[model samples]
Target: MAFTLNVNGTDMEVDAAPETPLLWALRDHLRLTGTKFGCGIAQCGACTVDIDGVATRSCQFPVEAAEGVKITTIEGLGAEGEHVLQKVWTEMNVPQCGYCQSGMVMAAAALLKDIPEPSDADIDLYVDNICRCGTYPRVRQAIHRAAELLKA
Candidate 1:
């Protein structure tokens, strides 16, 4: 089936099966590889993307369901790391291995949207993306820094 997905403010057409995961379509078809594939079951947030302004796991999201929804990948999150989260992530050096940074950023972005001034507990409750390099502390700091940057 051919599906038209609104990605990064642009409408692109792609051919995929009804149950094809959105992650494959974005990476294989749209050629947007910023969204990584960690765990296919959505346990890991490596394939996280912004769907309709919410952080969503793309690994399990069917391509057909993604049609007509606004999907934003890390590449679309900012123009060359201009987004607050991106800037903070870079400045704070959030990632140790960096494989999960994109997904972490997406999750953080959504958390900030919902809770502009999130507490430490809020950070723990949300932003549950796994990091194999044990960068949780840095991730939390980066999110806090990003929130401060947003205020400034």
Candidate 2:
């Protein structure tokens, strides 16, 4: 099947099976490797991306389902690598293995987009994406830092 995906403010036509996971389509078909694949299932947020500005697990999402939706991966989040979240992540040194950072950043970006100043409890509740490196505290710190940067 062929479908046109609106990703990162660009339209890309892909030829793939309807049931192909968006992760594969993005990485294999579209050659967007920034979205990592930690777990093929949705349990891991490594493959997270923004579908119409909503953080979504691309691994579980079918490529055909992404048609016409605006998908934003880590590559699209910043212009010239200046996104507040990216800057905060660098400042906070949030990643340990660096595998989950893309998804973590995407989730944090979405959270900050809605709640400019999210509390610790809010982050705990919403940012359920796991990081095996035990970087939760650093992640929280980065989120707060990004929020502050966004405010300034």
Instruction: Report the number of the highest-lDDT candidate.
Output: 1
lDDT (tens digit, per residue) of candidate 2 on 1-152: 89999988999999999999999999999998989998888988999998887889999999989997899999999845689888878877888998999999899888988899999998986677879998999999999988887898
Candidate 2: lDDT of 73? 94
Poorly placed runs, candidate 2 (over 4 Å): none
Error of 2 at 107 (Å): 0.3
Which prediction has the highest TM-score against the true structure? 1
What value of lDDT does candidate 2 attain over all alpha carbons?
A: 0.89
TM-score of each: 0.97, 0.96
* Candidate 2 clash pair list: none
The number of residue pairs in model 2 that clash at the backbone is 0
- lDDT string for model 1 (22-141, tens) is 999999999999999998999999999999988899999999999878999999999599999999888888888899999999999999999999999999877899999999998999
